[model samples]
Each structure stands twice: as structure tokens, then as C-alpha cells.
Target: MIFYHFGKYILLLKSVFRRPEKASIYKREIFKEMVDIGLGSLGIISIISIFIGAVTTVQTAFQLVSDLIPKSIIGSITRDSTILELSPTICSLVLAGKIGSSIASQIGTMRVTEQIDALEIMGINAPGYLILPKLLAGVMMIPLLVIIAIFLSITGGYFAGVASGAVTAAEYIQGLTTDFIPFTVTVAMVKAVIFAFIITTVSSYQGFYTDGGALEVGQSSTKAVVISCISILVADYIIAQLLL
Candidate 1:
């Protein structure tokens, strides 16, 4: 079953990456998708990122209750944890649910309603027309979102540390500036890109081949989210192993 689906996914990807019929039309579609997927998602991302960073700081501070350890380590720990794991992974997971399900349902609905068929009747490469722009948008915008998430998460940690009296503002700033590795940012970007691709492609595949009616569309959406999440985790582990 898995192999069958994987093979279909590969074939769909080949179709999606074909040359555009009209560069102007494709560009317009790409911009629209970027706004829909990126700007539309900012509010939820901001809320989750702030709370995740704050909680990480509080929890890390609580765990390191030792006189031998410097209080500034709370900031360092929170910074590293947020950048390395929390921001990219958690945010991608949230996006997989939000963006992935939307893609699946949108495409699935079009498939069921015969819109895709109508495009084909007009001599259009329906898959390329429908899915390519979304793929482009996902890859371009998700990394940008992750970058924003990283900054907001670190800021949240700083505020939480200072407000909780777990660490002084000066100590947090010092820790944040100390021993920062540029490579971690690269890893985060790599993860973000791979996750974005997985979310877009997997969900699109689920929707593109959807069978039956409205009930099936809902099923496809749910399946897309589930599959995208599992793919993200697998890709996350692989990227960490290779990059870190």
C-alpha cells in the first residue's frame, strides 16, 4: 500500500514540475498562493511561538536549580533549544495542519467538482497549473516564517526570563550573544525547506487523486495532515543526523 502511494506521489511530482504554459499566469498564481499560505498563517504562528519560548525558559530554569550552574545558562539553553528544535519543528507541525489540510481540501474539492477536468478540456496541464504555484509558494514562504518564528521565540524566552526573575536582562543578553553557532541557522533553514516541500507535495498528492465526493474530500484533508506530519518528523531526524 505504501509503495503504491509513494510511486503515485513521485509521478505526480514529475507532472507538477513541468514547464509553465504561461510565465505571467504562473507568477500571478505563485504570488496569490504566497499571500494565502504565508500572511494568512502569521497570527497563529506568533501566538504559539511566544508561548513555546516562554514555557521553555521557565522549564529550563526550574530544572537547573543548582548553585554551581550560572543563571545565564537559562538564556543560552532557551536560545539553543528554540533555534534548534522548537521553532522549526513546532512551527512546521502547526503549518502542516493548517496549510496542508487547506491544500488537500482545496485540490480535492476541485477534483470532485470537475474543475480540474475542465482545465484539461481547455488543453491546460492541470497538475502543473494547480499544484506548481502552491509548491513554489510553500518552499519560498515557509522558511521566511521559520525565520520570524526563531526571532520571536528567542525574544519570548528573554522576556520570560526577566519577568520570572529567573535571570537578569543583562545575563540573558550575555548568554544569547555568547557562543552562537551559525550552522544551527542553516540546519533550521534546511529543515524548513524540506518540511515545506513535504507538506505541499504530500497534501497536493492526496487531494489531486481524491475519489468520490464531499466525505472523501474531508478524509483526504485529514490524511494529508497526518501524512505530512509523519513525513516532517522523518525528514527532521534525517536532516539532524546529516547536518548536526
Candidate 2:
């Protein structure tokens, strides 16, 4: 089953990357997908990121019982955690449910409704036309969202620390700026791009081959989310091992 699905995914990718028939049409589609996937997801991403950061700050502060460890370490811990793991991995997991499921359902609906067939009948490269724009948009927009998420999460951590008296504002600010490694940001971007591709391509692949009606479309969406989440985690581990 693994090999079968893997082969199918590879074939689907080949079709999805084929040359576009119309550059202008493809550009418009890419922009539309960018709005749909990126802007549409911002609210939920922001909300989740803030809470994740706040909770991480509280939890990290609680664990540090030793006086030797400075309270400023809370800020540094939050910053590293948010940028390295929480923002990229957690946000991508959430997006697997949000964006992955949406992509699956939307394309699955079109497949079931024969819209994809119609495109093929018109001699269009249906996979390229339907999936390429989404792929491009996902790759481009998800990293941008991750960057925003990283900022919001760090800000949330700062607010949480100050409000709860877990750490002073001065200490938190000091921790944030001290010994910051630029490579962590690079690692986060790598993870974001990989996660974005997994979410878009896996979901699109599920939807593209969907064979039934509305009920099956829903199943595909759920499956897409599940698979994308797993893929994201696996990729996360691999990227971390290689990069860090």
C-alpha cells in the first residue's frame, strides 16, 4: 500500500508540474489561491500562535526552580521554542487541518462534479491547471505566515511573562537579544517550505483521485489532514536532525 501510494503521488506530481497552457491564467489562479490559502488562514494561525507562546512561557517558568537559572532564560527558551519548533511545526499541523482539508474537499468536489473532466475535454493539462497554482501559493504563502506566527508567538510569550510576573520585561527583552543564532530562522524556513509542500501536494493528490460523491469527498479531506500531519512531523524530525 505504501509503495502504491508513493508511486501514485510521484506520478501526480509530474502532471502537476507540467508546463502551463496560459501564463496569464496561471498567474491569476496562483494569486487567487494565495488569497484563499494564506489570508483565509491568518486569523486561526494568529490565535493559536499567541496561546501556544503564552502557555510555553508559563510552563517553562514553572519548571525552572533553581535560582542559578536566570528568569531571562524564559524569554530565550520561548524564542527558541517558538522559532525552532512551535511556530513552524504546530502551525503547520493546524494548517494541515485547515488548508489541507480545504484543498482536498475543493478539488474532490470538482473531481466528483466532472469539472476536472471538463478541463481535460478542453485539452487543458488539468492537473497542472488545477493543482500547480495551489502548490505555488502554498509554498510562497505558508513561510510568510510562519514568519508572522513566529513574531506573534514571541510577543505573546513576552506579554505572558510580564503579566504573570514569571519574568520581568527587562529580563525577557535581554534574553531575546542575547546570543541569538540566525541559523534557527533558516531552519524554521526549511521546515515551513517542506511542510507547505506536504500539505498542498498530499491533499491535492487525495482530491485529484477522489472517486465518489460528497461523502467520499469528506473522507478524502479527513484523510488528507491526517496524512499531511503525519508527513509534517516526519519531515520535522528529519529537518531538525539534519539542520540542528
Candidate 3:
């Protein structure tokens, strides 16, 4: 059974990658879904990013100030970590909890209702039609969202620094820029793309294989999000170790 499931998983992956970049047939429909995924999910990303930044700042500041480590290094450490690792990775987690589940649920529902089968009957490739736009949208939008996440996180760090009396605004800004390397942002964007692919692919796969009725769909959706989240967190560590 395990081998059989693995075989199915492999085939599913092949199906997705083999046609991931095909000219989309349902362009309008896919674009609408992309808009929903990218634009509609923006608010949650912003909130989570800022809040994480603030909390990270508070923790880092306390440790630095407590140890009497030169508060000079605080901004560099904070910004570098946030840009290269925390923002993109953490925001993906947030989206996994929020948007990932929604995608899984929506796709699962369609599957359970036989909508996908109907598409197949009409000579459409259900997998390609349903999953490609979402996949592409994930690729396109996550980097942009990661930028927002990093920015918000930095802004939160600034406020947190001021509130905690860690460093003056000028000093904090100066330190942040002193070691600011652009490669960190590139790493972040790369992470975001990986995360996007992970979330979309896992969620779509979960939803696609859903059988039975409403309860099964619900179960599939839950599993999709959980799997997506775990995969991303694990992948984040691996990617960070490799990149940073």
C-alpha cells in the first residue's frame, strides 16, 4: 500500500511538472483564481509579517541589551536574519495556514462534486486546467509577497527597537544598512518561490485525489494544509542550510 501510494504520488508529480508551464487554456478562469490567491491573501501576509518582525526584534533586543553586547550589532543581526530567513519563511507558514487550506478546500470541493470529472468529460485536462494557473500564480506572487513580508518585518523591528530602547532610530538604521547585502533578498525570493511551489503542489494534489463525499473533502483539505505546512517548515530548514 505504501509503495502504491508512493507510485501515485510520483505519477502525480510527473503530471504536474510535465505540463506546469503549458499555455493555459482557462486563462480567464485561472487569472481570476490567481487574483484571488495573490491579491485577496495580501492582508494576512502583511499582518503576520509585521507581527513576527516586532516579536523577533523584541527577543533579539532583549538578548543583546541584556548581555551588554554592543547594541551596534543588533540591527545587523535583526535585518540580516529577517531578510534572508525569517520573513519569507515565516510568511509562507502564515499562508500555509490561511491560503493553502483555502486552496485545498476549494479544490477538494470541486473534486468531490465531480466538477473535475465533468471537465475531463468535456475533453479538458483537469489536472492542467485546475492546477497550472495556481502554480504559476504561486511562483509569480510569492516573491513579491516576501518583499512585503521583509519590509513589514523590518518596519516592525524599527518600532520594536524604539519601544524597547534598544537603539536610537539613527543608530538602528545605520547599523541595519552597514551590513545590508542584496544577496539576502535574492535568497529570500528563492525561498518564496520554493514555498509557493510546495504549497500549491501539495494542496492541489490533496484536493485532486479526494474521493467520497463532503466529509472526505473536508478531511482532504485538512490533510492538505497540514502536509503543506510541515513540508514548508522542513524545506525551509534545508534551504536555509544550503543557501545561508
C-alpha lDDT values of all predictions: 0.93, 0.96, 0.81
* RMSD vs true structure, all candidates: 0.7, 0.6, 2.2
- C-alpha lDDT of residue 50 in model 2: 95
Leading candidate by lDDT: 2
On lDDT, the stronger of 1 and 3 is 1
Q: Mark the 10 consecutive residues where model 1 has the least summed lDDT.
A: 70-79
Compute the lDDT of residue 190 as modeled in candidate 1.
Answer: 92
Which scores greater on lDDT, model 1 or model 2? 2
Candidate 2 residue pairs in clash (backbone atoms < 3 Å): none
Expressed as tens digits, the lDDT of each residue in 35-149 for candidate 1 is 9989999989999999998999889989988999988888888888888899999999999999999999999999999999999999899999999999999999999999999
- Give the CA lDDT, 0 to 100, for residue 4 in model 3: 84
Candidate 3 residue spans exceeding 4 A from truth: 1-3, 17-25, 66-68
Tens digit per residue, CA lDDT, model 3, 1-244: 8578668867877765554334655577668867887898789888877887788777877777455566757678779888887888878887777777887888889988889889779877777778777888888887888898888888988888888887778877887889678888888988899999998888888888988888988888788888888988898889888988
Which digits, one per residue and each the tens of the lDDT, describe model 2 over residues 131-233?
9999999999999999999999999999999999999999999999988999999999999999999999999999999998999999999999999999999
